[model samples]
Target: MQETKPQAVSRATDEELLALGRDVLTIEAEAVVALAGRLDGSFVAATRMILGATGRVIVTGVGKSGHIGRKLAATFASTGTPAYFVHAAEAAHGDLGMITAADVVIALSNSGTTAEVLTIAPLIKRHGARLIAITGNPSSALAKLADVHLDATIEREACPLNLAPTASTTAALALGDALAVALLDARGFGPDDFARSHPGGALGRRLLTRVSDVMRTGERIPRVAESASFAEALLEVTRGGMGMTAIVTPDNHAIGIFTDGDLRRLLGAQTDFRGLAVAEVMHRNPRSIAPDALAAEAAATMERARINQILVVDESGLLVGALNTHDLMDAKVI
Candidate 1:
């Protein structure tokens, strides 16, 4: 060939991808909205069934529906309801033994006629376990055979191709979240209760994080006499690296505190830093908290008082330790 033409390279720009994302989100939002509108007496029935359950809630599903079911089970378990996931295919085998008279089973299938789920409906009934079905089809075997049915149907999948389970799964997941939250609210589940169930998560930190857990102890604490010189207080604050020193009296009672804030105020005021006593410049009757008090409470106290440092004291008013805003931030108590 004597000459050749250069072909243009094709790639999606950010705007094009963002436009596609907006379409996907809009479609999925419609699915969730449709799912909300469909909620009626059936949703109440499902919530009542789950609330009346004195035993674990066994959730079962197949394929992508199964993945949504697993998340639903976890949410229920974390939010005051006891629940677990059982793969539908495994139920046909000896796994059915996991179901007992005291258990309530919630089965999910978009078609409601999923062979894996239909295969064990009879066995679940035989065990005297109550059955609840979440399905798209009303007349399907799983829904007809169940004690209660919760509708989670969607108009169409958000997939441009119309075959993938995109919006359908999103609708199912949103419905599951609704059920869990309703049951949680119905039972008056509080933050403290949720923290107990999730001791390893941030909820635990907010609810269980105590002042003593992150506070300094013994010799590491910054302490000085109320009558101590400014230089001595500075030494104590420097040694602790917390930018503050606790001022205590002869009886070991906390009298005041000298912090970096005090230092700035003093420097700006042109006070006699070289000769002034710490007690003169320090904050008198400084606000403090108990060791057993929650770290969140401490953070709130710090913020409300507009102070960066606080003294940890005992019931007898003796200074036990000191903590700065940095300590709370480091522990995520703030």
Candidate 2:
């Protein structure tokens, strides 16, 4: 074996380096734009095929195409389509068992003639699984073998030598996104559906978290009767630590709310509080929300009403729970 010596590279000026970066972006952007214009009925057909598939979508490829395929599979799955990526070489080594007759296989190859992918194409077809090929060459074997072919050909690579997969990979990924989005629309996938798939994400918290999930229930909610003394209401607010206390009737119906802010304003006004009643100081018509409403809707209401806390009431207008800005923050719903 011969040892290879490294060569000294010439350093380019800052402006020259930036120019190269800009050129790469421009080339890749142009490739994507051109791909959008070249979209025809084949794109529509691919979407319809995936939408109609009774089983999962199996995305497979090799090399750079494999990376794109993996991302495409994740996108499809996250957007309501059941899909996953299987490396082409692995499929040849028995991973092909994952594919079923009802599955749809999406194969990606820039040249449309990857030997590893070609090796398994027949086996996939033998299983009676449908194939959708994304390749640069429409006449290539993979394209011809496919039930539907998506042309992802780019004018040229963004690589300086035009040998690396740059613009071509971008085009394929964009085409996959287009197909996934179209299928999402066809399935009528809404934010709630998306949130279900991403339960740990922020969107999920905003969409799926109801006020009842974060509101303080039972003894955690600070409550004082409307006939209670002002000092008793202040004591409940302090003990509750929610900065506010709900003033309820004898039957637990919320009548008004009083907060520390109200106390501060009262103190500033130099009002005598020796024998004041909670009903005398509490703000009537305090903002309230149903326990079943979204936490996001509760946050919106709080913001619009310029209040830090809201009382949760049932259909009968009985106090059920209470939450503040801190609770929303704790739930990560804000």
Could you say which candidate leads in lDDT?
A: 2
lDDT of each: 0.88, 0.95
| Per-residue lDDT of candidate 2, residues 229-263 (tens digit) | 99899899999999999999999999999999999
Off by over 4 Å in 1: 1-14, 201-203, 300-306, 329-334
Give the TM-score (vs. native) of candidate 1: 0.87
- Model 1 clash pairs are none
User: Which residue pairs clash within candidate 2?
Assistant: none
Q: Please list the residue runs of candidate 2 whose C-alpha ends up more than 4 Å from where it truly belongs after superposition.
A: 1-10, 201-207, 268-275
